[model samples]
Target: MNKASRSTVYDGEVTWQRIADEVGLSRQGAKHVYNKAILKLQKNEQLKQYWVDLIIEGRATKCD
Candidate 1:
């Protein structure tokens, strides 16, 4: 699934461990994917808006 979709699935409250379990990835792998997805969104202005909207709407939240 796409990063945004995956992020939505857990209501944005997913930890790396949770992502690892759900996606069958290692913790580090999940972290890498999350970071990469954020970077990609940041680099593109249009996508950045979507990312910001998601954050503002509480569609995505940082994992503790």
Candidate 2:
């Protein structure tokens, strides 16, 4: 994930509005971009696994 996508995940559990605020986008726009990125990642097993590894290594910090 990119900076914007990471920010979305960080704030989505609380409120996507927070993500929008952080990323300078509207709430709905943030949702759209986040959903699209997730779908893309899901469709690529290798990329998904890479993301999982990064998460496990604690290197997935809001866009590392």
Best by lDDT: 2
| Deviation of model 2 at 51, angstroms | 1.0
**Mind giving the per-residue lDDT tens digits that candidate 1 earns over 1-64?**
4565565644436678877877788999999999999899989999999878987776344543
lDDT by residue for model 2 (16-42), tens: 887777778899999999999999899
Please give the lDDT score at residue 64 for candidate 2: 69
Residue 14 error, candidate 1, Å: 3.4
Give each model's clash number: 0, 0
Superposition error at 19 for model 2 (Å)? 0.3
Report lDDT (CA) for all predictions: 0.78, 0.79
Please list the residue runs of candidate 1 whose C-alpha ends up more than 4 Å from where it truly belongs after superposition.
1-12, 59-64
Candidate 1 global TM-score: 0.62
**C-alpha TM-scores of all predictions:** 0.62, 0.65
Q: Lowest summed-lDDT stretch of 10 residues in model 2?
A: 4-13
